[model samples]
Target chain A: MVQLSACLLRKIPGPPRIYKRLQTFRLNARYEGRSRNCYVVGQGYQLKSMQYTRVARKNKVLDFKELYNLRLEAAAEEHGIPFRYLWDGLRRMNILLNRKVLQDIAIYEPRTFAGFCELSKQHQVDQGLNLPPHSYPKIPVNTKGML
Target chain B: MHDRRRVLQWATFARSWWIFDANHQCPFQSANRLCLFLEGKHKPIYHPLSDCGDHVIVINTKHIAMPDRFWRAWRHFHHTQYAGGFQVQRAWQVHREDPTKILKKQIYSTLTGNLLRKGLMARLHLFPEEDVPEGMLRNVSNQIRQVMPVPKTLEDYPIEERESFPRVFEWPEEYVVKDGKEFERQKEYLDEDLSLSKLQ
Candidate 1:
């Protein structure tokens, strides 16, 4: 004959170490309660949420590309540098800076972007492009607008 | 050797400038929508602890709309620490005073409780109408329309000939409620008339 000892049963038992970690992994954290009733569904939900997050992570290329383009366009426009002219001239000179960098130079370091303007105009002239020439450093100087 | 995950990671941390057109848009919806961009919650790289939000330029704030009757009913209340400092102003009144305040406050409130909230709010540029500064307009490469239809201008209405058509209700030619006194007086009168009509 053998005797059995009584033991308390846990609703969803897991060691504290693993349980704490799973709790932290909740996607909609606000819905996580102390009851611990969601262990089964929680893991599945966490997985799905993570999967969506991965997709979102990968799609940022387009967003950044557009942002950089806008910044470059705006920065060039300020000094009366036509966007196409600046882009084309830079390409010709192999000054292949991304729009992200171009935008920074446009907003923060106007002087540097201005250099690009001079380069852009000079290149356009050398190439004999028919487009109306924009002056270098169109800054309150005499004979402005003549590249 | 382009890995999908690797490519996303590179883009995820980058930011962008967004445009929010508030013409005829519900303030709450637009503000919440802007919150996503401001907090970078829409990004795959969004971490609650990180600053991932993008810049947003809000235009046509002058035409932002609220549901019918909410303008009067929705009150923005405030108080000073002193006794009897409590005050409540209707939504329309506040909007009338400062066109950008309502949406700005909404978006600000929608941001999660984080240190980056203030910085994100700073990135939000609000303009009352289409007349944006040349500098700000230059950076805007795209536009995001609101979830609702654009408000039609008076010019969009069919010929003035249609103005004379009969309607279920019309504003009395002499109904002047520009002043609070006149408006209160009219409200009382309208209330009595409405009750009498109901009884009839």
Candidate 2:
């Protein structure tokens, strides 16, 4: 019965779990909570490990992405450009680097990161992506004569 | 590679000076925002172990506003670490004793209680009014935006702009409430007329 249940549990598509009844001998020596003490302990450990692995795996990616974005925002703001413009420009230019790599470059290789920022700024200007939001008038009263 | 790394180190850790105009801003709220700059939390490189905080110059502390009743109700406590040294004073009383003391105390309390607190406080320069010393003023490279907008009085508007403001309707010249004495007298007359009708 134990082997059949363990086999059925292993078929579920998730982190692999080890199933062994070696601790049953120790359970027999102690009369703690219930009759099937070893079985209960094994099930508890399996469930806890499965939940922990699932949550940790899911959140680790999100947490690192947030950290990278935060660093990128700070570095980009220092050069007087928004992070949105920098990310968009990088994509348009086919720089093809993930946020993690970009942030690493920002810290260790700031000069190169600054060059990336400048290139993005130029791209934004050329494509007119640097302009104010669509809600704003294309030409304001004060600057109407200049253009 | 070494030279580039050297320049990057200097650029990343270099301290910047920030100026904040505290006119019409609440002292407590202003302290909440100013503490970020004082502790370098505004920078992405902020770590509790790192001392990368920036210098902050706060001007017009004399004009800091407190919410209604806070001036009289809020009490600041201090202990001199001696017998009978415990003292308490209202926010306004402290402000009267020193115009900049309220803001200074607020910022001090908001900052984390750590060994670096004293060093971080040293970077903060507070002026009661707009008269910053020439040397300190020269170092300012950026301005922290004010938490609240300074309200504009009628006198602040130019006459041309005031006259050009569009209005849906204008008050009648003889509106009784427009003249305080006339309004009081009209109210009294109406009361007397009503009393007479009741008596009759």
Candidate 3:
């Protein structure tokens, strides 16, 4: 698993400590009666029920803001691409490639992502051009209509 | 000729570590310093000509844990390409189905882009359960090591303690509760609703 560097964490200002505490509290309360040990394998614990419950609940209730922010971070790590590139690509594509797919490509298929980046760059350049440049230097052009 | 002999010696050393003993649970980590001592990139004998590392046999693959916040937030995706398009699942789901895939992915990710990675990864054997492969467990005793458990970090604590944790069901959203007496009642109501709507 890629550990977020302290510098990166510092870059993204975290939510208030109290807000995080409350969120944690609610999550625990939601899974209070559920079986926590459903997936414990061997001496170590597997995917615990409480963890799943919390994620599901969080997704259902939380606003897209936090989720999107989380996805942004995920996209950066999973794609092995820089955060700025992902941000720029997302804006250029105008398509919301969810955090999950971006992360997968980051881990499994990187070359494909590089191709995506090149395409986005091309699209941006085309969109920027208002008129084609003349190959030859303009001979002292006279506007007859204006005259 | 000299390089071949060195490669053979390394392979032999790696194979020797496979035997299970009474005192060691994970002998590679404990007795042999498998994680530490198996010097692949650092050794002078190391040749990019061949895969010179020892084979790792991981007995249990399902039990590995990530640091705090990873289990909750990490999501993986697969593309279907048709109408439904992409499907998303978490890391936990992948781990549950095939635990060995996790180890294989990690190893593959770290290895240099070469033909040697295929040969090296082929040697890794990962089992979900405690059962060793037949004929391989020759007079070996199952001496489990007592792993020292670490305390959970602040982020690792139960979600109830966190403030930003969302509610189970948000208001105005229709959701049916499943798996309990309420679920049965809800199922009947849903059926009735469907039937009534069909009649209209």
Against the native complex, each candidate's DockQ, computed on alpha carbons, is 0.02, 0.21, 0.01
Q: Is candidate 2 or candidate 3 better by lDDT?
A: 2
In candidate 3, position A20 carries an lDDT of 51
Give the least accurate 10-residue stretch of model 3 chain B, judged by summed lDDT: B19-28
* Clash pairs, model 2 backbone: none
Write model 3 residue lDDT over B1-200, tens digit each, in one string: 69987896655334322421212132113322222112232222333353445544556555555445554345556678898676655555556568656545655555566766676666555566567767555533222222224446667777777756667956565766454488567655755665422422
The candidate with the higher DockQ, 2 or 3, is 2
**Can you tell me which runs of candidate 1 are displaced by over 4 Å?**
A1-147, B1-12, B151-154, B158-200
Give every candidate's TM-score on chain A.
Answer: 0.65, 0.62, 0.33
Q: What is the lDDT of residue A124 in candidate 1?
A: 68
**lDDT score, candidate 1:** 0.71
Q: Kindly list the interface RMSD, in angstroms, of each predicted candidate in the order they appear.
A: 9.9, 2.5, 15.3
Q: Chain B TM-score per candidate, please.
A: 0.71, 0.76, 0.49
- Residue B20 in candidate 1 has what lDDT? 83
In the range B1-200, model 2's lDDT, one tens digit per residue, is: 69987897798799999999999999989998898888876665755667889999999999999989897688888789999787777776678679999999989999989899999999999999999999999989999967777998788999999989999988798875543488567655755665422422
Query: How would the docking of model 1 be graded?
Result: incorrect
Model 1, A1-147: lDDT tens per residue? 333433444254667776565664455475556423466656666677779888888778777776566556545655566677788888887888977777766655668888887768766665667555444544432324444
Report fnat for all candidates as fractions from 0 to 1.
Answer: 0.00, 0.24, 0.00
What lDDT tens digits, residue by residue, belong to model 1 across residues B41-145? Answer: 544344556677788899889888898888778878787979978777778667878999899988888887777778988999999997888888777765554
In the range A1-147, model 3's lDDT, one tens digit per residue, is 354776665456677776654544443443433322222121122235456667888786555444444434443423233345545656766757865565455434656655554444344344452211221112322323221
Leading candidate by lDDT: 2
Off by over 4 Å in 2: A1-102, A105-147, B1-5, B81-85, B159-200
